[model samples]
Target: MSDQKDILKNLKTSSIDRRLSIAKASFLAGTRWATSNATSFFSSEKDKEKKRKQVLREQARYLVSEIGKLKGSIVKIGQMMALYGEHFLPREVTEELNTLNNQTIALDWDSIYPHLKNELGSKILDLEIDPNPIGTASLAQVHRAKRKSDNLDIVLKIQYPGVANAIDSDMNLFKQMLKLTHLLPQTREFDQWFEEVREMMHREVDYHLEAQTTQRFAHYLKDDSRYVVPTVIDDYCSSQVLCMTFESGISVNSPDVLTLSQERRNLIGEAALEIAVNELFVWGEMQTDPNFGNYLVRLAEKSDEQDQIVLLDFGAIRQFDKDLLSVAHDLILAGYDHDLDKMVLAMRGYSFFEQIPANIKPDMAKVFLIATEPFSSLKNNPDIPEGIMDEEDRYDWKLSHLHNRVMQRASKSMASRYFSIPPKEFMFISRKFIGAYTFMTVIDAKTNLRNMITRLN
Candidate 1:
């Protein structure tokens, strides 16, 4: 009933800053509770493995509860935490973080009309805007819209207000809380990574940056008719607002999108890989967020051409530099060669220099093979078997083979030594391929992965 209560009650994740603050508060509060009740949070420390599991669960729950409160950008930051925060978090916690989504809240027409007038300085009817949002994400919600003058239909992404402010506050508070809680050490390098993440989160709330990335992607995807990149409405865009013509298409993840003919799926898959490779190797400016839902499969009713592959959301583009670029190439080559020495060497080049136990190298090799096993089967995708081969030849079989090999030799204890890739830029690049591989695995796509490796080499 009071002003303070009202302010707290109205705490919505409109800006990066506000959500960040909430996330910090959540973490700080949760850590205090967990620490105070450390004895109770766990069932028994006598059983080391059970204790370990309980500790991990307690930590993950603590972080997730805190982050879930921040509605917009803060929620996005939590998702990013899932991706890049592995070194600082327990594996179980990381797995839990992966489930965190920045559920976006939709705005009604009355609110949207005002935003359009304010951003466009014209009436809502003056411009064509989709009544329903085609898609949504943590920081911003999107709507399909158009410019009447150009007769263009495009996607309009609008940022929630107060997100940036929330982020700035939350980050500073989180940094200090992390030190007090010892959840993440106060290492200089990791501190730098946190700062970078904070910067990225702030940039995400600025729709203007997003608009530029969209245009840049359009240029990158030029000459590819199968791909549809949105055109930026700079005149109608601002830091908190991004307006672009909506590309008519359905999400590649929509259950129906998958039911498309094999050729259609393969065509889109290949196109996605092409864009991903070009962005990673050539452009160096990578749109790292593969919100699988971001891509839309345009129906043939619009054109007889292959279904147009539309890439949406450019708020999380990561740029790669010379050294990072070279090392990434080395990584791919190493995998293609199945050269354990080269792979270890490349892993080192990328910073995986943690002390390895005497017998762990072989275990790591097995793990690597399992992780890369499917791709190792064929150099060229075209040579890949169309249907699932017998159990031994199936993709799942290869993964199982690799995991089994790893389990056979790798440290069974969590404390056992393990090989890891040092932190760097291509982490997301690895995910892009991994995600693509999963999709391809389902669709039975066989591509000459060797084709790309050969070119890189």
Candidate 2:
């Protein structure tokens, strides 16, 4: 909540300085962890387990705090790991890493002005730019500006001076820090995911790609009145800056959104879900980052107007391969039918699914059924809990508790040996669906999605 001021005159772009900082933090955390293990050796058996978990949490928290202090790609690296490393990282460690703050301390205008001027050049004189940042993040800060000729409102996303160039080195240092603290496992799976994080990091900083993506989404949703995608201003865009017309809206979770009628909320929720479905089934590309900050709900001011969901920030877009998309489509279709045989068949062609034991495939299929419950009619899925679906066949997201049930079933079915890290593509697709599910739950939407899924098929 702090305003942009002189918190950091400049980012520490020097590799030597960042390396030393991470090394020092890792060494201290490592020492504490070693001391805790040595102390646990003399404890009673039952107490040992309890004491060790507590110390692990403490060490994880200490490491995250240190990482939080160094605001740049490293902070983003921690966040990416927290989001995708659930299978490989210790639960306690990932939980602590999740606490790494994304709303970093803002750099002062004096420091930011130079970068803005360099990107905008003489175009900077044509607009009235706000000296204070409207929002701040680890890699960039956003400011509001207006055109002098038309008084048009727009927002500029300005990347930090050297964050992009530092990504590769910062990533290497982050891995070393984890190694020094003995918090992460060194394996092929971890190595592969690490590379994924690196690619996503680079993509996030590429303003040209983000602008094109924004324009792409805008074109796709242009005819849909229920959604709004900001117009990209090409003249104001640069490799380091993205400019788009300012679209006003409230947070999706705002109290004001909850005040709307049930019908209105359902419409809003469905619009959000349709975007996810279209991304997976039609376009084969998705905005993988689902942070609430990227969405805003624009409540209609008049009875004749419709409520709208404003989509923002297209930096984390992930494009899917055709083979993977086909498999994903099969899984959903099989889940809709609640047929274990079809579900098992759909699991073909994916490496992770191929690795699962044949006997356990049925159990995994059941998990898939639970996940796609909202898209199934009561006739197709008779085992759905009573009161979860209404007489009208609407699925109440707030009451379903589907996420927990899926987790429980997956844990009950897959033995430790059979469980493996999913493909990176699956992780992004699943995350997008989960984000949509969360949006519906937050809006208290009771939507009958059977028609939607059937139409897609």
Candidate 3:
């Protein structure tokens, strides 16, 4: 009875007042840092600017540390700010926050034990759980365990006591902070983007829902020998706890992976590309967060020399509506042909541009085409300029300057009356694509990504 009361009390603590306190602390720290830095003397104009940048960097680090200590949806928000919000934030802020990506600070087991007992009851005594967690995530920490019944080794994901309650409190405070700091455009469209994020956060905290999502994805990929997904152990799962078979492997970008032969790396890369295309085009769903921590590589059971991929954490699965999927297909097709008019029509239908300037529409279309460059082939469009794709079909990510071109085009679009947020669904899906593309670029993995698209159909 006391444990139940404690759980309720803990959730109450993650209220709006607490969230506001965190936000207030951050704002106060920022103000102090800026004031002190600005008042300090410097030898020259260049030195002053350099010192100011250093101050900003230190402030950014402080913000990351505080959020890490807070440990809940706010940590997840810090992560998104590091990745997608980079455009809206100071470069120093985003660069410093990037260090927190997939970095989790776990709660001590004594602090976590009450919730585990509440959820699992006497069954807790029948299981052998490690005192320390194997890994920690924004909402939960994963510990290795063994079922006493079948002697089965499994992984248990235990949510922080108040996270579900904290979602709304954290997000509301985050929204207010963004408005206060001018990190997001103060518009109805941007508000909708946040509403979707709020919904996603709520879903992510529902462990039962995550279990179902993981099961569905396992079924979806079961036949594919190239990938592995752990089976959910249903009897032990609850809204705040999840149990699954244990699977281990090397991190996707571990030094050992880099030591593999070029041919082996190419196979892994091609497999990754295939997964992305099939998920978006064929499955009509995706695991939106593609952090490298969510992936692993293991030696193939049948062939020691070959490697297989293991996928983890299905909390961010998103399903596409038919209309959205159709728009995506049209945009991709138009982009391949470099058909400006068709591309514009497709994008407009998707609410990408409420009112783009007539003069800049062609440039917008070109930018969209450049985005598809990473997934395109000269075989499909032989007339595509040489630098974008080579005879060997390798997409030259660096040579194309994809990120710079997209941002420049977006800045131009923002200057025009065309400014409107596409629905949150589109933004999240695009994020998945970008995450996959960036991972491929990091490993310098080459694949005729176009060919993988055909396999989707």
**Ranking under TM-score, best-scoring first?**
2, 3, 1
What RMSD does model 3 have? 5.2
Clashing pairs in 3: none
Residue-wise C-alpha lDDT for candidate 3, range 1-457, written one tens digit per residue: 1233222123224576566666776686657665756677655888887877777777677766766666678777777667665435678888877887745556767778888999998888889999778887777888899989888999999988877877887887766655544344666665666676778888888888899988988998899888989999998898899999999898877888877776677678888877777787888988888789889988655555468889888988888987788778777877665567877787665545545665677766766776776666776565455676668887755456566667676667633334233456766777887877776666666666766655433
Cα RMSD, model 1: 5.9
Instruction: Report the C-alpha lDDT of model 1 over 1-457, residue by residue, as the tens digit.
Output: 1223212232354445554554566566556656655655544555655665666666666666666655555567768777877666667767877877634445454545565567657545657776566555666667776668777776667665556667776666556545544456556667767887898887777676777788888887788787888778777687677877666777566667668776676566666666776777778877766666666778676445567777877888888877777766665666666667766666554444336543555545545544554444443222223442333332433223333444454445332333233354645666666566655654444343434446666
Query: For this target, which candidate reaches the highest lDDT against the unseen true structure?
Result: 2
Once fitted onto the true fold, the runs of candidate 2 whose alpha carbons sit more than 4 angstroms away are 1-6, 415-420
TM per candidate: 0.76, 0.96, 0.84
lDDT of 2: 0.87
lDDT of model 2, residue 352: 82
Local error of candidate 2 at residue 288 (angstroms): 0.7
lDDT of each: 0.61, 0.87, 0.73
Q: Indicate the worst ten consecutive residues by lDDT in candidate 1.
A: 1-10
Writing each residue's lDDT as its tens digit, candidate 2 over 278-345 gives: 99898889999887888999999999999999998999999998999999889888877878799989
